[model samples]
Target: MTGVPLLDPEIPLPPDFPNRMLTHMFASPIETDIAPSGTLLGLLQRGRGDGWLHALAAPRPDAVAALNHCVLRDPRPDWQLEHRSLYYARLYRELDAPLDAIGEHLFDPVDALEECEQRTGLALSVLGHLVTAGRQDALALLRRYAVTGANWRWALDELAVREDDAGLRELGPAILARFPGTEAGERALIEAVRDSFEPRPWHLWAEDPARSGQRERLARALEIGDFDRWQRQLRPPTPQPGWSVRAVLDWAREGYEQTPRQWREAAAARCLGAVAGPGDREVLLRAAVEGPSPVVRAAALRHLAERGDPAVFELIQRAAEEPDEELAQAAVTAYARMNDDGALRQARGWLERTDELGRTAAVMLARRGSAPDAPGVLAALRRVVRTRGTDAKELRALVEGSARLAIGPAVPVLRHIYRQTISSQLRGHTARALAVTDPTFASGFAVECLWDCEEETREVAAHHAATADARVLDRLRSLAADPAEQEGVQTAVRGRLAPS
Candidate 1:
């Protein structure tokens, strides 16, 4: 229920779409070795607001080289999710950087066979921004890539946003050629039309005045795409666990038979809320604690813990210490789902332990703990910064909790996270927290935050940065004027302005 459009996972999607196999290997998070922060490469890698500032001060050749390296290599911890492309594109514009390096990277035939959006998404995104900024070369390159590249859809989506209606109309035949007359081809075309990240091009082609044949075909695709989406909305596929406790237990057993550790118990547990009754409580309790089926036992434990069943509270505490790490994680997650006073008390009790459950407990308090819980939350924040540093995923929850409680004492740690974390999202969270906890933020990070890589961070800066600083005023006015800035950031900038 993320509100994101999804293809039916039960049906086979186009093999060309990103399919992440669990068996596939991955490098560690942010493990790509970055140079010193003082260097241009490192600054861009970190996506720092001041990256361009450093680039401007460096030699033009050095700056261009660093910028090219970053754009081509993709320095993000997770390229699929990060926001470095627009930032890099802006730098490219500022530097008037050449497109040769980017062009070469985009067309590298060596990596063409293994077509993942991860390969060219950042480059295409940067080129998209450049095209919007009036780089005709970028527009032309994207047009060509749409025909030849493995990641052509990304290029097409970019073109959809910035290309002229005439330019889009010309591509109708090429896009149509992607599907042949076969049944599978038609379905693929329908799926592509359905799963498109941007629909403007499709919508435009469906009604092109001069191209009656293209229009008819595209119109059919649009009609079918809309119908498929509507059908999915009207009746979601049936749940595998069905509508009763016994059915759920049987489903869990079936899942366990397929994969010992990859059982359907967690999903089965979710169904228990609708069907379990007084008659089923003992069965659930027995399955949770003593059942021969590991899957049933796990599901029952999750259901009970999620319901905050006091009968299973001790089981939660003990299971978190189980020899099976997956079971321990499942048990701890169930414990965190509890929203009762007893859960809060349990979280408070575990504040001293540094295990996963202990950390989850600390986060629980940080999120839902009261005024009296502020001290514990602050202590937890400090301890995590000391133990795991600012980039730790755990810090995101704790930083938000600190902000929620307005814990002034947590300012130092929040400031540290803002300064040290290489993650733009984490830095954004820290910026928000520091706005409340740090009085000096208006004159300090707030000024630099105006130039931050992430739009949301800049939005926060706009709301809080002091008007007295000359840099703040200039940056805010620029952001207000910049068409490339997000609507939210521009709105925030406008809110802080005097009426012209």
Candidate 2:
């Protein structure tokens, strides 16, 4: 007769035999009320049997699981009395076990930290002996323990020395509270606060509710000149509220001397809101002109323009000549907003330069197009669109300018550019431009580009193209038979290409 397999063929053996054996050895009987009711007898059964104790005593990594199973399946008062601390320590070790294996008892953060600290205290007593015995690895092991849990002060202090931002971030507020006024503690608090300002996803911001509190904490730290952490909080999307404008000004004034582009930008943005006296404008103006960051220069130009001084016009003129496109754009936009004749004259002069520079100058010029010179600038833009290559920037200028000018000449170029430019942003703009310039110019090119583009662009293109080009109907008919395209794109294309 053939013997049955010890394990069923369908139930494959675990890769680690010791863990599998430990698991199997403590497997309860089918009818064992091994549920809640079996606890008392399970404990009594443990002492009477060699199998449970032998499983616990096994010399393998799975030994921990077997021991826990023995204690949990049947707990006894005498067993606790005999091995209270040992059992607690072993259970603590399982806290670091794989997540599925981590028991409920090991999850109490406060209790785990306390026990870990106590174990560390006792372990340190033997460290001297180990050192004397030349156990180099022993020191490293002790160092690891010293850095774990509630006793993480030393690690934070060490991390601060190495300028480890992520490490200091992990140590977080608990270490901040523990170390208080110490330099490392101060630095950690500052870093924690500053890190809070980093641009996070909206979902992430909601998830990290403590981030607002962390920001407040960082702000308080800045008052005392813990500059490192104070500045950390100034990253993107964080609106730097006016705490002490004078203090921030002082820092900006000091910082701009050697500040990186990002830091100068942050400070310049802050100073813009601060009500500066006459001399403050000079400081800010210097930063705008010679500051390391173009963004900072842009902010400074904005600050000066908003100051209501006619002098800001000449300052902006100088900035508009700067090589940095973003700063020049800011200057042009600012000058347009002022709407003075001098500002318009400067904008027109700048428009005569490169297309990249001309784009911003044209936008400002378009806004002021009701002025006497507006028609000439519009004509120049019409020329640029018809003649320029199919780059995204030129396409955008063409499409946007055509919509603004409502010029018929832009129709062909916009259509051609839409077909050639790979950028979905430009493609969508081209469709809209064609619709705006002359809705009848909509054709197979519009439908083809819409099909070729992605979500937002496809939606925009379809909306304009279908409304204008009835021929998009045949294109949709052909697109329907194609299997390779996404359903969302096809559905949107169909919806736009549908009647009306």
TM-score: which candidate is best? 1
Lowest lDDT 10-mer window, candidate 1?
Answer: 1-10
After the best TM-score superposition of candidate 1, give how far the Cα of residue 250 lies from its true spot, in angstroms: 2.1
Record all residue pairs in model 2 with backbone atoms less than 3 Å apart, i.e. clashing: 190-229, 194-232, 194-233
**Best candidate according to lDDT:** 1
Model 2: worst 10 consecutive residues (lDDT sum): 29-38
Cα lDDT over the full model 2: 0.46
- Model 2 clash count equals 3
Per-residue lDDT of 169 in model 1? 89
lDDT for model 1: 0.79
**Model 2 lDDT at residue 393:** 50
Can you write out model 1's per-residue Cα lDDT over 1-500, one digit (the tens) per residue?
Answer: 01111222322222322432222222322235555444567667778776766786789999999888777766777676678888888889988988998888788885477555776778899999999899998888899888778888999999998998999989988877878978999888889999999999998888889889888887898999999998989884445566789888888777777744456766788788778987888899888776666667778899988777888778877778878776677788788788888898989999888888889999999889989989988887877766665566778889999999999978767766665566888888899998988898887777777877888988999999888877778888988888899999998999999776
List candidate 1 segments past 4 Å from native: 1-31, 36-38, 234-243, 259-262
Residue 439 shift from truth in candidate 2, angstroms: 5.2
